[model samples]
Target: MKAIITVLGRDKPGIIFHVSEILYKVNANIVDLDQTVLEDKFFSMILVADIDEINCDYNDLKDKMDQLGKKINLQIKVQQEDIFNAMYSV
Candidate 1:
């Protein structure tokens, strides 16, 4: 399945690396990624990751983000592409 993952939390070093590395380790291909920093917060949205072959299906992706959440107290969510699209339509 394909989707967009958003990470939002306090600004700090290595946040991108930490997140991206997990994606890489899971064999997810990042087709597009855009990130920015504003004040003391960091925000990122990533698209085009191929997670079909990933173990544990899509839940593994969630777990990876969850781990990061515990480590940095960040909010991370991975959504199905259709769900995300529908949300924007409303």
Candidate 2:
């Protein structure tokens, strides 16, 4: 399985490190990633992760990411690629 992970918040140090740490803990392999700052304050990232061998289920991973987001004062979300595509498809 694959998942789309998004993070958005004020730009800060260690954001990528913390996020990547969580993914690493779960053994989620990052396949693609794009991140940038907007107006010097908004930090946004989108990543495609291979979750085939992830240690936890989809919802569990999402929950963990959510908690991490809360701890870091960012907004983070994880969704299965298929569902994300379906929701955004025209």
Candidate 3:
């Protein structure tokens, strides 16, 4: 299923490379990405990637990502695109 991974943290050189490398390693297809640095302390990135190739269950992916986030010192989250979109439905 399609999903979106959101990352936010301090802006630093190689932040994109580090994060995108992980995503690419996990076989995620990056469909879209938007990134920005606010001031000098906070930076954010929103990536929409297709993860239909993930072999395990969604829960497993979430756990792996939790570890990834902790490793990188960034707040990260993954959500099914439909669920995320529904949350904003009106």
Candidate 4:
């Protein structure tokens, strides 16, 4: 399975570290990632990860990411690749 992860919020330190930590714990291998800070204050990131061998259920991973986002004051979202594509298809 593949997943799309997005992170957005005021720029801050350790955002990537914390987000990647959760993925690491769940054994989600990151296949691609893009991140940038706009005007040096807003942060945005999109990551594609391979979750076929994750250690926990998909919902569990989502919850973990949510919790981490709350703790870090960022808006983090995880979506199944197929659903994400379907929703955004032209």
User: Could you give candidate 2's per-residue lDDT for residues 1-90 as a string of tens digits?
Assistant: 789999999999999899899899999999999999999999999999999999987788998999999998999988789996788898
lDDT of 1 by residue, 1-90 (tens): 676788887777887788788888888877777777776565554545767766556877788789887898878788778886787786
Residue 88 lDDT (model 2): 81
What stretches of model 2 exceed 4 Å from their correct place? 87-90
Off by over 4 Å in 4: 88-90
What lDDT score goes with residue 40 in model 2?
94
At residue 43, give the lDDT of candidate 4: 100
TM-score of 1: 0.81
For all predicted structures, in order, the TM-scores are 0.81, 0.91, 0.82, 0.93
RMSD of each: 2.2, 1.5, 1.8, 1.2
lDDT of 4 by residue, 1-90 (tens): 899999999999889999899899999999999999999999999999999999999999999999988988899999989997788796
Error of 2 at 50 (Å): 0.4
lDDT of each: 0.76, 0.92, 0.80, 0.94
The lDDT, on a scale of 0 to 1, for candidate 2 is 0.92
lDDT comparison, 2 vs 3, better candidate: 2
Q: Alpha-carbon error at 50 in model 4, in Å?
A: 0.4
* Lowest summed lDDT window (length 10), candidate 2: 79-88
Clashing pairs in 3: none
